[model samples]
Target chain A: MQCPSDKSKSAMLAYVLKQYGIVIALILICTALSFCSPHFLTWPNLITVTRQISLNGILAVGVTFVLLTGGVDLSLGSLVALTGVVAASFAHPGDYPLIIPVMAGILAGMACGAANGVVITRGRVAPFIVTLGMMTIARGLALVISGGKPVSNMSPSMTRLGGDFLGLPIPVLVLCGISAVSWLFLKNVRLGRYIYAVGGNENAARAAGINVNGVKLLAYTICGAMAGLAGVILAARITTGQPNAGLAYELDAIAAAVIGGTSLSGGIGGVGGTLLGALLMGVINNGLDLLNVSSYYQQIVKGIIIVGAVWLDRKHGK
Target chain B: MIIRSSKHFIGMFLLLLSALIYSGCNRDAAPDKKTATDGSRQLVVGVSLMNLSSEFIVLINKAMLESAKDMGIKLIITDAQRSAEKQVQQIETFIGQKVDAIILNPCEVEASSPAVDTAIAAGIPIINVNSATKSTPTAFVGSSDEESGRIAMEYIVKRLSGTGNILIMQGYMGQAAQIKRDQGADEVLAKNAGIKVLARQTAEWDRAKAMSLMENWIQTFGSKVNAVYAHNDEMAMGALIALENAKLKDKIVVVGVDAIADAVQAVKAGRLDATVFQDAAGQGRTAVKLAVKIAKKEPFEKETFIPFQLVTKENVDKFAR
Candidate 1:
């Protein structure tokens, strides 16, 4: 084993650098931007950006898990809306018992994930196509359930997730906790190794006696669960379960994952890098507002940055 | 073999427990109400809305329903979700249900013409609210986007001393609101050469995108940018966040249309300079009134323009929750 150790060490170093290159670049960009703009480094602005990115970050954690297993989950966005609406239905004033809605939301997301998993595994459908169909169906169900309305008048207990603690949002803390758990799972758990093995080569994993289908199913279910949790936080933040909430959020999650150096090809990436990518995006958005830039050109710039990131990744392949 | 048998048993028990839990939860939840009495002389007014995602539009829908109840009319509302085709289907359904009148917030000014024509051919009176379709209806009731834009521009000019580089955040292109608002802003720009229009782009009424776009604009123009004009409160809120992040909150003036609760709060907090209040609730109520009057064969104006107010910190407290 020691004979080829030197070459492997260099290769591992290269892989690690490739995985975190975008994050390092983003930090550099933020540092330079902060120097250019006096307001960029302020405590209030940093808190605002962190609060804004928390929900997306939490959702991205689950999405990263699925992506690591070489699977895509488009239904995550719709699941968020569905969970939010369902959870809000359980909300009542002075209801200190928040378990009902939280559990309901989690169950709803898990059920949706199970459905996606069953459809893909049992029906022998591609994950992309299956999840895409699930996306439309789930969104329609959300509208049908909510009657094209915003579910408002939520309980204060439910609203506490969006409130501040020591000048930081509770949701941000939740995001950090979720990220920590994801880190531990991906780095140390047997299931995490199985996910990487399955993603790296499904046939090889099956040959090695690993349950490939089961691993993929678990990945999607976890993604769904995380999306549901994100939905609850979103509903609390907005104080409403908007039928149209989380529309196009899948794109943002995918973008964050890709920017964080998660290979679309799978078996690569981690929650830490995804968090950094999401923060980069949040900072850019917040900094732009502070600078008073027009919204139209902002989109073009964001698209260019996304494209540029992928190009950079390809150039420095892991 | 014994260990395998125990694992199977545990799995089966968990499955059974999950099923039981699901059923129990389902039973406890209230059943959806779907029954409605038929054959009454109740006036059914069909409302086809463009979108219900925003708080402003949601407030308008609630107000419309409340006004309809007061006017002794039954409301049948459908959200188009920003799809013209879906709105057309909803209108067809309304016609099938024999609705007495139709109130439409057209997704597109031109694409809604066919549906408006169908409603007209069916002898059902149609009223346009918040926005108008290309095909004229019996009554059009909503704020003048052009006027609102002009008011927003005037405020920006006064704050910037008639000279500054302003960014214009446009809405969905080809839509009535976008067209009129841009026209109004252009008219103001033509008058004041001193006030430069640095850049103009469409945010499509998304806050996150608006914030990102504003950030790039900052990188491009640096400190030359003086103010931002968003088409809606959401975009304005996004722009304000961007400005705050850049430490330009107090120096730059930000204006947006639709005095939504968030925008109102922003104004009160001195984060946003001004926004045009279109009176969404009033618009909804007036549209219902016009629909009822038309159903009753009473005379009403063909085009009813609602008043718009430029709400600033001084007046935002009255509008804020």
Candidate 2:
């Protein structure tokens, strides 16, 4: 009995290693890259990486929640663009108080998200198709509202959200805060358990008295709201609301989630892993920049890294 | 379960609270029509921009607005966000408002013809700026795309000694800029047998996308790539970032157009070889001036071609803002 127990312990260890193998590999890659480039380990470079990660980190957090409920939010990126433009309109200097623009921006994002939720839940359409349609529509709306122009002169307080906080960007802080709260929610909240249940087996979750539709709506809403927040932060950072802002951000968010060990099939990941994935991407981009890699080659390397992570995940059955 | 319910309730409450706050805020912040400059009897001018989100367009618009203000012209601005449909609607709105003159930076040359016609039918003299439309306007003010492309190619050929593998990162497919630039690059490539065009792809004017495309090209071509020519500075900047990452910063020469702020800085830092300066602001000022000229029956050139300068490290400081 004791010998069998030891074998089981080793098996559990192997399983855990397999599940987190990509993260370990990512660490190893960072170490190797750091050794190769002296600037890779610097404080400023690290902070830049953190700042870059915040965009995807925030999006991935929302994506993780959706993935937990076996759904996807393709409109998050477009929502960001739309919200950025809308918020920028409100951010006209001396037009209104700071809170007005900020609240309006947040509301715009929520409304967009709510619309997405309604289409997916009430309309009973597939989340993928619904979001894909939304992506175009929202982007079009963004362009329309801004009159094909970039909205500038955003409120100073809004811009402050993108400013530095204790040597780090406010966006990075927000990302960290979001990550911590999401982790806690996933681990300690019953809705979190329901999300996992729904992803693991929707029919089972339904039978267990979980309102799966409500969970999905919540997930998508969160995704939209977070994307909205990201847009606001991005607008603040760039000091302009660009209709073209957050273009192709969805790919980055999805890639980060997958690389961080979120199974595409859903129900197997958390914000912690997504955070790691986002960090990995950010570090790689910063390192590449530091090493003077051409932008074209950087993209190729990013694709490879994403594929490698996925391959490793499959190989380890995680 | 209780904790979950309470959290859900809190979330719902926050959502409702935010919604109420938003409505209230919007109500308080409505733009006052009465405060708007009264131009009821003035020759109203409508400015339809392709997109204002980019620095290039923003600068152009600012210049135009300044010119309009100086001339005491009443101008109404509308943004198309790069949508032909939206641009059409904006033109219709201008027509409805009975503007005396219209300035357009068409999103698509052909797609904007109907809208241009609509304005023309309404007797509004149109001045197309930065980009030309298929329909003739009172005057068109923009740099010659073909010439700029030739200049860019000339710079690259001079730098690479006309013998090397080069990659061409195209802009949006079927756009006037892409067509002209490609034509110019092709003319040069056809003549220089030693210079090989390794790969061509569209960066779509996106820095990140351009960076990724350039990265892939580098990975495929490695040190064999002698130079890169992007349609615009943003894409070039993206390529520069990739080259910097791969430790190939000084190995390959990179050229771009638009000579944007960042691109100019890159050239100053010796990271980029050259960029073509479009003087977008000048074009804006010129467009507004021409619109007012046509509105007032003043003679203006049928077509005005703005001169573009090839900016390099030697001449970059002169162009710096």
Candidate 3:
């Protein structure tokens, strides 16, 4: 017994809630944390939180592409270690120009990604199995290359990339730049639209004469390149290429993507939502630490929030 | 056409079979190759480590290798990758090979104990190095984790004149080092009531984790943090880096366990205040020597405890390289 106009109004409200629920939740959490901990809303603490999440953010953004194309990259954490070591080897003082190390890291990542793409497309293997294999292969390569020790003594100029630029942290700025370009690419580019089409329906995309394999390949390669960039930034931040660095980092990145409403199955998310998801996680961690909460409790709270966020997303989508 | 293709496939298969056999024979000849060069069957000692990826364990492995080379012993080294099950399997493989002696760097006290029993049953002398196994081995060579904890805390207490707010960056929870180090630190804390521990958290003995944890603490505690005691040099170095980033390194006293190369360098550079030296080389050397003696049917001590040393700026030069 509702009027047609009233039904449309409620439908509009539902749409807004579906799209911006995470944003509202993030705001509420931030407000609550600001009240609970005096240190939570300060400028320095905010910068620190952003800096902490930058590595995972870059990774999450990259993986979003693969996820959109109905694929997942389990090799992110290992690739981070491998590329970090490769970049650090060239990052020694007076060894190479800054750009050389950066390029080496990114190229290493891109090659691994391209390899993954080739195997998945041409070799006709599942993304999960291929990436799982790549995970171990990359880790082994990292250990062998670095001889099971942290590669340290990076040049000061390279290390400074981990520091502040103008007033903001360099890593956070990098994340912003990457997020903007990627967001635009996903929205307006023909290849970007094709990524969505392939993920949305593989048979339909093929019927429409789209190159499904090529799009999927590009998604994974982009994912790998992001991982490489993240690795270099991490090495610069820690001032070493630690063989054990980025352990379980992929899990965190995936969680951020999933929490942001990106479907594990494919074709349902964007950078805006992913950044909000990463921001929520960062704020929660910073809030817990500021409140002096025990790490054991912090872990439990984080797990619950991840599950809860995904649950809400599912409920709203349906 | 079908007959010719089948014949070609058969020839390729035969070539692959011969190649595999040749490689197998080469592997079988490795032990004898050493014997042929040595002019005698050299004493073969099998060494299994917890994890080689860790810097500390690698140091122990390096020292053992050096000592084995100097003593003309053939050491068969295997990495368990921190798996107790794998460590036991390696020990069994050594037994199958009829090794003269066995050296074990255990991954856990209880989980790695079966390795010792299996070696004992096979009538091979086994020495536990760097860590303990619940099942008694022939001999043990390790520095006391509790003593290391006590030494690090004592140095911090001295630096602070017995009164200050401190934080402790722990290793992985429930680890032997973590528990004993905590006990040792608590013992010192119980004696000095004026020194208050503001917070203690686990960083898993990882540099990156410790760095993040320290950064958070800086945000929460601000200038109230007076000192930090990390369970390992990696965590210590991490805390130092975080403190340096915040420009608070000068006001804080940072100490850690294990005088790793980086930690020693930090101490010399007047960054890290102090780090306890666990003597990886000494432990490794002694374990290998004792293992050889037991294999040769010579008397050996059942327990060998290497004392830990403290490395500060003054004494860091001695410990460095």
Candidate 4:
């Protein structure tokens, strides 16, 4: 029989493969597309893919925490819409300082997230139902606030948040910052350890004196704030407070997390994997666009790839 | 076995044919649909709309409602809510109710047409509005999507002197507006061989998405794109944002469609070069008017086309109003 060390080493190898599979997939797609499209490997095209993926990347990082804690937030998309229009309303030309509108948008999402937490914890409602209901409410509120149209003409300074910083686009920088901070948070903080415990086994966590509800509330609230930040970035980038922005975005975020090998049952994921998953999605989109593939076939190809990824993951797990 | 199966097929076919004939002639039984016999300058017209949530569709609904009030016509409106099956059900309900005539703002091109056929088979005159159906109706009252694109392109060709590099921001692919608008742009491109198309992609009728797409194009082909032609105003407004950020606002001449309020403001401010006026209110009014005419058996044209006009800075006010 193999020694315990050898078995654990094999297990470690398996874990790494499962977790870093998305990175490998992204590299392969990039390599293939680099050969297929003459423009695919260029610096400008790669930057385009990174910036395009940033919004969804930040959202995936946020939802990754929620999924790790054995819950899902379906309201992220609508929350993005709500925060975006709110940010645009305040960020209108010379209306307010840039920070005020930016914070206002993030705070709105936090409040909405906090409320979702309260209902799920205090009211004993399921996370899916609570977030689903909030999804509709938030989308309707976005429509009402924006009067069923896009809010435009945001301040120039406000729009600059979506522009370049140093050498990189502000959104990609923001995405990088969020990912680093999230990685550290998961690695270092005491609450972070408690989060893993709570997700691993709620009853065991409660027995161990971990505040399960508090940890859950923290996860969901952070998810909300991230969603808000994403909203601000998109609105500023587009220079509009669009109520219709981020439609069905939650699906993409969830898909990224899942494709990155995050367990839906709880307690197994990280920002690194999520980033790779987001990059894979971004590369696929860029590659398809570069090849001038019709959006219809693009959708079909994307769906099949997602399904195939999950199927391979499941088989690997077995 | 072949003979037996054929007999079963014949029986099912006969059953369906008789059912259609029965439903056609005995339409007076349903308590919901009022017959024209009791009418005294009172007409009941049933209308099925695509989706009520869209701002443009809401404007269409408002115009129709206003026309209904002014003409003293009783209108029963059904919201299809973007579901083709729901639209089919609404059309069937209109048929069963035996309304004088039916107005259909189709949710889809083909799925919504067969139901309109059912209303026709029931002897109900149908008026199709805005988007077309696969099968023709008694009357069609709306501006063609292709015509909107043509008006925008014609103006662009004039401004560019028939030759310039341009970017095209499309709507949702396979959507009626996207296909027809691209056709119009392609027709213009075909004529002006000197006009180079730098890039074309579907932004899916989204402002934020379009803005990012424009930003990517800027990165890929900076300073090369001389103009932008968006399938809709939302995308145009987004392109305007990207251009303004890159300080290309003064260089590129951008045009769009729909003439939505924001686009109108953009045009008025001289930020957007031009936008094609889609006349949502006009389509709504004409649909109602045609429905009443068909109900009253008054003389009317089979198809009424609303003209799409280019809304440049010079003619912005007229289109805006």
Candidate 5:
């Protein structure tokens, strides 16, 4: 009943809405917050918000790869703790160079991620179950390694990772660098394309000569490494490697990815959208704190926004 | 085919769950088996701590272990892991074993009360340590949470000369410590007409969280914040770090409850203005002593209120050791 051009035009519009709607939602929330709180729009406050979201943003980007491959990494929070302890023990005053601790933390995370990948592929277990097991194992490992106490007395250089560099927080700069690189990889690389194909349809991807298992292994390893990096940053910022840190952090990262239009079923999302999602959450939290809103109400408001944003995007997408 | 595979998965899941549950129960039952093997007429006391992850709770646990060894008492200590239900189950296990007494570091005033009731009903004398439950125990040993809050706030008020904007960093919201500390702080604040509370929020008794919250508050309140009162030393340390980073520590007076080793050290170094001492060692030793007294049928005080002391630079040395 409609002309082909008109039909294609409507389809394109729908595609754009589904892809970039979260950005618009984020902008609207920021605009609203600016009207509510004078502090919300200031340069310093903006920098603070970015600094706060940097950890989650790094995590969200890492999980975006896993989500794109139809897998999930629930052990992210535990890995943060485990890697943090490993790094902090190495980072004590004059014990090792800053690179050693940073590398040790990330490598520890990568090893755990590789373990998750092996179990999921070799054992033929579901990602959810495999990751759930790793979650407990990693937490226990962190406790065992740290002796159930926070690791303190970190070197000044290590703690400087949480400070400013060239007028920008180092953590935020790390997030930006990671996001830029990830965006390029996902957009241009063959392995990255295979990630989408595998998640889109496993049998079809296999028929197309893609190494499905390898791609999944890579996805999980990358996620774990990101979690490791986040752990190091958190440890540096807090000036202690607390074994109990990063509780429920995975939930926030996953929420950010989901809010960015990443499907739990996979094969749909990118770094740009994920950054917007993390930014949206950061802005809301900063805004609420600036306005002196009760944390009880802030929790309720956060829940509503997460669900509402996703629901709206899905509805408009159709 | 999907349904059949799902059914297989469910069966496997159940098997794993049962294995986990079995291991957990075995861990709890190991001490009872050890007690039976001893076969000596040694008095046994089972202690259910609120959570051993906290440094303060660990201190209490360490002191309890030491005193129990000295007093020749067989102690079965279990970490409740912040779950009242788990604490109740642990008490029930202790009752089944017919321990001489039970010591409860309650997780909640109401939720943990059920554990007290179950213990008392089984004719077991339960000694509450560190915190309280709604249902009264045979004996209690701890400093008052409210008193610690009052002491810390009163110190801050005095430093500010009774006129300034202050911030309150709470612990885990709705916890016994959080509620009573807020109440005690309010009692002090209400009397001071010039002092005003600029903002209050929970960092969930976490250092990193408090740091982030403090950073945001610094951006929001800036120079207006003259003082900060944290529910615990960990949070106070966090706020102090944030203030130091922002180059505002010298201007702002910071205080916290629980004169933890680090807090005491900080006070001595002049990094922290003050902290209230809850005397974890005192509470732990007293609880063990009282439990032994109840078991031996010796007269003991039903309530032992260990006084909280304010730890400032002047008094830091006395508490540091």
Candidate 6:
């Protein structure tokens, strides 16, 4: 009886650490950086850090749902470039209403997402292979459409979307809004519940009359749509449609999800955790920049932290 | 058995690589043998480019292709795709064919030297173009990257009356242009004690990344940032755009290198304060012209350096194209 009671206490500790380690990491990093750089604690610097990480945060959120369904989408980065190029093509200065380019970009993303969902479900192919193919196709299409050059000279109104409103950057606002909505959808909605079920055990889910394919399809599509929205916002931020934009962004999104305690094996994650993960990444980057760390060392540091966090997560899973 | 291990995949990759090299060598041998039998007066030149994806390289390739045709020279052009290994293989093929001349646009200084040395040992004159190589070449035709940086900094130094807090937006670290330009700009900054560096960071020669970085810098330094100096026009334009959005464009002086078409337009429109000229076409044409001379065993200089020019509103019309 004493041995079993001690085992349960340790198990509870591990569970709490697994669940809340990312939040703790974020707080610790912020506290440490505040001491390293005088600017780290300031409001403007904090907002700047948030805005810098907003792109990664939005993308991390998009990928979180798919991970919950035991799927992956490697095409988010390429889709970002594609959506940005397409939207910027239609977003000349004052020529079209702000809503037109905005809608065009989101619709393009949704259309692409739908295609990804359709193929992954109907073809019965591995989600990894399908999305990997999309990564190449989307990147090639972006380069072809943009002629291997950047589309620049966007209208003021279009660029303004990347600017601030009500003393807050638009990207930060979008990230928060999306996180709120994703939380509600993932926590309260029925389809969201089905996602967890399918991810946990697909065969069991199918036996229980759940549409496992539909849940996966839903996850992949939403992931793609969010990637596209991030893309359009990025184009607005940069004021150009760069064919080479968002290179390796999918990896970052996946890293964010993993860091937030989203198991790659699936069935466990949340947007709230992912958002914290993104902020954790952002704080490290911003703090390093503020501290004037050499860029070469910066890469090494980032790589080590990423691997260590993932390794710890895996240990918890085992 | 279920995993279908990665070892087999690697084995297949090696087999493919060996096959490619063997075929490449055979093709080179076959072409040269035919040329020898025919005894044609056609001077075959091989051009190995660093990569053909960039507009600048495309322009250079076009110039080389057209000029080779005009000179009645048969040309074999290969795109290295930014791979040093691919470039070395191309050089090996050129040596196998005993081509009259080889034009090498190296991917890097150290990685490409051995291959170019092989060409030189084969008695083929290798002309280095645009970029410098570690091994000495028969000749080089390119502009001084430092001069472009110097011109841009000179303008900023004068504009600020030799004193201001400057933010330097650098390019991809470890690249030739990035290193030389920083050296040039920093030399000037060091001379003027009144000048202070607010922050310097590598933006990796990207406009969007530069813009984002600039936005942060603006938030950090704000009014104290009296000038913005970028390593190239793209970054300069990015900084300008960010500054405009932040409503801080009026007091700051912005300068950049690379008088690309967009940068020229920006200069014309008074958005970019100044840009220094880098003559890509001139360098391309000169490289071909000198490669022909070296191949023909005619008189040619070991080093032909092109000059860099400063472009401002004062002379924007002259270099607008």
lDDT of 5 at A32: 91
lDDT scores of the candidates, listed in order = 0.80, 0.79, 0.89, 0.84, 0.89, 0.83
DockQ of each: 0.19, 0.13, 0.63, 0.29, 0.65, 0.41
Candidate 6 ranges beyond 4 A from true positions = A1-17, A94-100, A107-133, A304-318, B1-45, B65-77, B93-100
Residues A13-128 of candidate 3 have per-residue lDDT tens digits of: 66556666777678778999989988888889988899889999999999999998889999999999999999999999999999999999999999999999999998778999
How far in Å is the alpha carbon of B234 misplaced in model 3?
1.6
Q: Rank by TM-score, descending?
A: 3, 5, 6, 4, 1, 2
Q: Per-residue lDDT of B263-308 in model 6, one digit per residue for the tens? A: 8888899888999887777877888888889877799999988899
Off by over 4 Å in 4: A1-7, A32-46, A122-126, A300-318, B1-45, B72-77, B92-101, B121-125
Q: Write the per-residue lDDT of candidate 2 for residues B73-144, one digit (tens) a residue.
A: 767788898899999898897777667788999999899888888887887788888887888877789988
* Chain B TM-score, candidates in order: 0.85, 0.86, 0.91, 0.87, 0.89, 0.87
Global lDDT of model 2: 0.79
Q: Which ten residues in a row have the lowest lDDT in candidate 3 chain B?
A: B29-38
How many Å off is the CA of B61 in candidate 3?
1.1
Please give, for residues A129-181, the per-residue lDDT of candidate 5 as tens digits.
Answer: 99989988998888888777788778999999988999999999999999999
Per-residue alpha-carbon lDDT of model 4 for B1-321, expressed as tens digits? 999789889989999999998987745433343334447646788889897767788789889999998987778888887898999898888776778889999989999988778888899999999989999899998887888888888788888998888989899988898999999878877888888887788889888777777866676667888889999998898888878866888989999999988898888988899998888899999999988877888999888888888888898888664
Using lDDT as the measure, name the better of candidate 1 and candidate 3: 3
Give the per-residue lDDT digits (tens) of candidate 4, residues A52-171. 899999999999888888889999999999999999999988798899999989998888888888888877689999999999899889988987767777898998999898868999
Q: Given candidate 5, what's the lDDT at residue B113?
A: 98
Query: Which regions of candidate 1 deviate over 4 angstroms?
Result: A1-58, A79-184, A201-214, A228-245, A259-318, B1-42, B159-167, B193-202, B210-227, B241-252, B265-273, B313-321
| Chain A TM-score for each of the predictions | 0.94, 0.93, 0.95, 0.96, 0.96, 0.93
lDDT of 2 at A249: 90
- Best-performing candidate as measured by DockQ: 5
Model 5, chain A: how large is the TM-score?
0.96
**Which residue ranges in model 3 land beyond 4 Å of their true spot?**
A1-15, B1-40
In order of appearance, the predictions have TM-scores of 0.72, 0.62, 0.94, 0.85, 0.93, 0.85
Q: Model 1, DockQ value?
A: 0.19
